[model samples]
Target: MSSLYGLRPLPSHGRFGYSAITRRPGYAWPNGARLAVYLGFNLEHFAFGEGLGARIGPASPEPDVLNYSWREYGNRVGAWRCLELFDQLALPTGCLLNTALYDHCPELVSAFAARGDELIGHGHTNAERQGDMPEAQELALLAGCHARIAQESGTAPRGWLSPWISESRTTPDLLAETGYDYTLNWAHDDQPLP
Candidate 1:
């Protein structure tokens, strides 16, 4: 049986003696079999010592906000390593990009865009919470994210995947109003209900 984190059990059979066994989200169920493949990647890293981060704006994301470095990580190098690995594999991935990432690494964004990779908004930065921020601030920052996306990818985003899955009550409604196609801030269900 397919599972994530190797702990959560699969769902049981529902009504009519049927169980959905989906492998990934947005996939077609074959004869009530739930199976799908996910194409996703999270791109995050810091350039400085990995502490205070860029510390530019009032809402700049924290670069770990703790130590300069740690086990199994490097400052500003993780993304490049991942990029190289993905490029070598010729794999397509969806980048849940923090706008700060774009502002910080335009070249990296270009690399992904060149591969036709999907870039979903991950807030203007990875620090302040879009779901927690005031609505006005959120909207303004979202607009800024699109502007930067265009600047980096040469196109505006059609989706939003908030950082850390920072979902709010109004996130769906707001994204709908903003003309987004979908969101990736909820539990991953194999069935495409929404």
Candidate 2:
């Protein structure tokens, strides 16, 4: 297909075969409910002054305490408050976790686990992007995260959400090979895709 500018369309991610939403058969939700809601809470950790993170101000040199601390505030304070609210509301939460939290603040992860929240793998830390790694390295990373989460949480995560939502060409295949049942990498539709 060609664009208005006469440029060829970009290649597709071949794994996701197309199926127009309107043409696809409808399915009922669990408990015959008309709606479904899930809270995806992220709990990530970043290296000090090294690697990617959301910056609030202009970039600075190494040891960027300003940006590092800004992101840190989430794990330090924000997450706790959010946890309290979730508990009070009796909400079920799926926590996309960075395994590094095991070193930084294990209590936080334990608190969520104690509440019977679902823990999903989200890489070791947000400091690095999985998309940039070589295939073997990415596989190792995925497998390691799976093992760690299973060991810590007492169950393997059935889902994954890459750091920064980044993925290499082989991510989906790797996810399947490594035993992940689903991923949050794609957002082309409101409903889940095969």
Candidate 3:
């Protein structure tokens, strides 16, 4: 037992070691403003009769048409309306894109690209999660997403937000290898941390 049991420091983990924000160097944001804003608009697709999804009603056993159709509405109609609103407000957005949207309804994706919004990788689809995949499979998913976004959007995505904010142990390493410069998975604070 130590003299001050309650004051012992905990061991640090992860590649980013612990450091208090107050002790770190301070810098002003662009235009000398302390805040900046960007919208994270998610455009996703789901597999029918399988995997995970958000629901507007109680869970059905399987092949839930009500829920599936509800989600599909966002792609077919809702996203367009939202885009129009963004344009009216003259705001920039960062789309957390599911690559499946490229095949399912490319026009929707093209609309975002036309507005010069940033496309951030959000996997091939939201039906499954990257955290559940093995390392090799996760890497493949990351690489596939990078390539798809670059080909379809014309500008390659500089960041990623794992489907459902899910990731395997090697996600960071894999993201770097696949050319991602940032991630939205962690939001512990207003400022971006290493």
Q: TM per model?
A: 0.66, 0.93, 0.91
lDDT of 1 by residue, 1-194 (tens): 44655678567423123336654345556686666556777655444533223333343244443342431143257767888898898878888777766566667767778889988877765545566778777667767776777677777788788765776666777777666777777654545445
Write the residue-wise lDDT of candidate 3 on 1-194 in tens digits. Answer: 55467666566437586567888788668889977887899999999899999899988889998899999999999999999899999999999999999999999999999898999999999999999999989999999999989987677899999988997778989999999999998766667765
Model 3 CA deviation exceeding 4 Å by range = 1-13
How far in Å is the alpha carbon of 161 misplaced in model 2? Answer: 0.3
Clashing pairs in 1: 21-34, 22-34, 22-35, 23-35
- In candidate 2, which residue pairs clash? none
For candidate 2, the lDDT comes to 0.92
Candidate 2 structure quality by residue, lDDT tens digits, 10-120: 788777777788997886788998888979999999999789887898888978888899889999999999999998999989999999999999999999999999999
Give the top-scoring candidate (TM-score).
Answer: 2
Q: What residue pairs clash in candidate 3, if any at all?
A: none
Q: Specify the highest-lDDT model's number.
A: 2
